[model samples]
Target: MTASYPHTRLRRTRATAWSRALHRETTLTPADLIWPLFVTEGVQVEQPVAALPGVSRWSVDLIVDRAREAVELGIPVLALFPNTQPDRRSEDGAEARNPDNLMCRAIRAVRDALGDRIGLLTDVALDPYTSHGQDGLIDDAGYVLNDETVEALVGQSLNQAAAGADIIAPSDMMDGRIGAIRAALENTGHSNVQIMSYAAKYASAFYGPFRDAVGSRGLLKGDKKTYQMDPGNTEEALREVAMDLAEGADSVMVKPGLPYLDIVRRVKETFAVPVFAYQVSGEYAMIEHAVAAGAADRDAMVLETLLAFKRAGCSGVLTYHAAHAARLLHG
Candidate 1:
């Protein structure tokens, strides 16, 4: 007689922890994480962001200590964003090109301390430095100018590369900015500096905490919908990714990660390139709030969420929970 039951039982492999590990199709490791650090002006200063509980903006000196911690935790890269002082910010955001600016100082400090031990991914955008809090130069009507913005981004990319940044990540979402930055880098003898384009950043409500952390919340005049992608368009995201790739992005990123996993999976399947996702501030804040409310286990949730990124075909993730998740993975 033939077998009455199915020959293969999928649950059999998941019955034991060891079997589950052995059958795991995706893996999350400390090296796969990129920790985003916010830098402020001053010495030995650590200012907590109220909106993003457990997250703080550290001064350049303190940022080096965090870099050390990240290195010890086995995190591969650090993404730096600066809280430009009000006095320094201008309509044109000229401080962004200042070699002595906070971002550059923090980049140099980390590179001085860690050398090539870790990769530095510096954000190439103007919102942090712009008094008007737009990612690029704007008109009197507040419309973000694409070509002019791309020119500023190129200058910012060259500035960061000169400061020892390994990756110039343009999160500005300006059309043709990636190509402009890439050509500038090559011509300026930074041929090895990788361009990680924020290819599919959508205009979402999830970026509130980030704006607060960067000190741009109060300065922002209107929404960023004029430049950022629409949340309702998946096909548009694919087209954006294609344009960025053709323009010379070494890797591409999808912002506001968890809600955009479908986009991540689609981009990965379509491009088969190094794809990264940013688990944005709102996502991090929600997880923390849940843990505080006793509705979820922090350790379990952090690991599970990060592993989900890996499973969703993300080559890596830029997360605020990177260090904590790394500790759990290490344990």
Candidate 2:
């Protein structure tokens, strides 16, 4: 079988680990990770998210400590999601606008504890604060209203910014919210704050574990098809990314990362902006289950899956595996 092709041996570089490392095309590191932390009420409590094996919902006091650990690991950012008490959940998600709310308080606490040691990203969606869990104000007909939701998102973004949030991430997918939030941030003198819009969030079944983390699954009355994009279409994702960029999004995200890596690649290719991906709750859970079942190696799977994002043209990724992956990379 070894004929004239024997002259071109590809095994030379693959013979040594050092040689392979020197020739690696893409490198994964702690700097590329963004840890998603769930914020709840109380002082030092850490509640495990049942659906997501290694993840937990920590109170503000404990979250400050976690943020410090993330900084020590060279992880640059932490995205905050709140688990509001049932009593605080309202139809209009008015609690989201309160400057002293759980999310805002956590943002301030982390900022004060670590200063600018790490970037603080606060979620601007209302599903965590709403009883109906629609991510926006629901009409009598059960439809998620786009314009009205944008107005509330503006208020939510302003509140987070007032609490010292470094970035206002609009995950609600409501039309025109990015422009409105950008304008609000400017008017409120937060001109330097960044906007990372969840521009191509598809309505996917992979969001179940995420809903459980925010305590929104059981409260959700119906599907969010009206707002989040349909998974069947890819051109629509390009349009959404373009619109968000035009509206002043500093970076754009394609959610449920593994399933939509194609969308990530396409958006990055067409728009040439900073494209981020969310290795969402269910994706984490699936890998965890396989590892637990002895079907896969945890360390190998984590690094491979993360490198997949890099290969697919992601600038950064929001992942629950950030700390673990960072430790592996640093090792």
Candidate 3:
């Protein structure tokens, strides 16, 4: 049977790749990718993260190579996370404020090698440096103290800024830390350093692989529900974003990208500011596992998931698949 169609047929434009490209409302590019790299302590060492397949922790020397690779790939920014040695981990997480710590060394090394070619976004949380594997200072009861944590974070931010970090990313989810960090940065001669707050970070189960990558999974005593947002709440996510923005955050991030795209869209719409999402370690692992099990195509899944962030109004995304996706987009 033949059916009559309307004069404007959407299928006509969708019939060709060129037509689709010309009509594409959203675009993904290497410029929209922020590659996340883990830095370890050694020379020319690359330790593979078992939980996060295809991801590895590179030493300071090798991190320079990775930075060069990112520059060659046209990736504008790199987010650095450190895997502090167990001996360096302490109850006070004081290593986070060390001028010569692993994170500071990597920042200085990359800045010295690459100069201003790329932006360095440094994580300001203390979980990697803490013996208790918490993002902040804890009392005897093990509760993460908000004010004390903010003070430590201010110091951490200043340390990174002194080490030439271009962006200070406070991922601790602590209240009022953004304003404190921003003020500290301004007073300490780092007025240009940006703050990308993990504004609506949730205490989600998807962070297990990340914890392992940072070497904090085994050390974590309890959940971060007391600080990070509850996954079930949406309005609260907006409030978080609002507070961070008001606190002078240059940008805001929604973590575990795919699962919280709704939150990303909401934040972007409500705030009308730059919104970024983290295609976190577990999200990357899920794709890798699916491909290994022959359940999906790796390349297709990576691009599709990344493009979803663009469609959801993300200014850019911090993705483990950044390099691979950039290569695919180049092709």
Candidate 4:
């Protein structure tokens, strides 16, 4: 007689912890995380970002301490964003090229303290340095000029490289900036520096908390629709990735990771390159609030959410929960 039940039972493997572990399709670990830290000025100060909950804007001195902690946690990299003071903001974002500026200084401090133990990544954008909060120079018509921005980004990338930045992530989305930065790196004897372009960065509402953390919240006069990708588009992401790869990006990133996992999956499958995602500040706050409200278990939710990115084929994630999640994994 024919069997009443199916021959294959998927739940059999999931019935035990060991079985589940052996059959797991995706694995997440501390090495898969890249911590994004906010850099501010001064010493002995760590300002908690209200919107981002556990996140903080640390001073250059404090950043080195955090870098030591990150090394202990096994987190492989740190991406830095500066909260440039108002007095330093400029129309042309000239401060970005200053090797002694906040971002550059933080990079040097962390590298000097940690040496080659952890990779240092820096943002090659003008938003944090611009008086008007635009990512690049704009004309009287309020239109962002592309070529001028690319030139500035090249200078920014060189400055970061000089300060020991291992990766130059161009989040500004300016046209041809990746190729420009890549060439500048090679020509200036920084051939070892990597360009991890924000190839598919979307102009999403999910970045509000990040703006606050970086001190660009109230300063932005208008939206970044001119450069950043539209959230409504998908295929455009692949094209953007292709262009950036052609221009010499060592890796490409998809922003606001959870909401855009489909894009992450597509890009990973299409290019087969090292794909990364940014679990932006808003996503971090949402999960934290849910846990605070008793709507989710903190440890379970964080690990599961992180594993989902791995299942979606992301090689690594730039997340706010790096250290906390690393502790859970190690435990």
Stronger candidate by TM-score (3 vs 4) = 3
Write candidate 1's Cα lDDT for 239-294 as tens digits: 99999999999999999899999999999999999999999999999999998999
Tens digits of per-residue lDDT for model 4, 17-75: 99998998899999999999999989988999999988899999999999999999999
Error of 4 at 135 (Å): 0.6
Score every model by TM-score. 0.98, 0.98, 0.99, 0.98
What are the RMSDs of all candidates, in order? 1.5, 0.9, 0.8, 1.3
- Which candidate, 1 or 4, would have the higher lDDT against the true structure? 1
lDDT of 4: 0.94
Which portions of model 1 show Cα errors greater than 4 Å?
1-3
Write down the worst ten-residue block by lDDT for model 1: 1-10
Model 4 clash pairs?
none
Which stretches in model 4 have alpha-carbon errors above 4 Å? 1-6
Instruction: Name model 3 segments beyond 4 Å from true.
Output: 1-5
Global lDDT scores for all candidate models:
0.95, 0.93, 0.95, 0.94
For model 3, the local distance difference test gives 0.95
> What order do you get sorting by TM-score, best first?
3, 2, 1, 4
lDDT by residue (1-331, candidate 3, tens digit) is 5558678778999999999999999999999999999999889899999999999999999999999999999999999999999999999999999999999999999999999999999999999999999999999999999999999999999999999999999999999999999999999899999999999999888999989988999999888999998999999999999999999999999997999999999998899999999998889999999999999999999999999999999999999999999999999
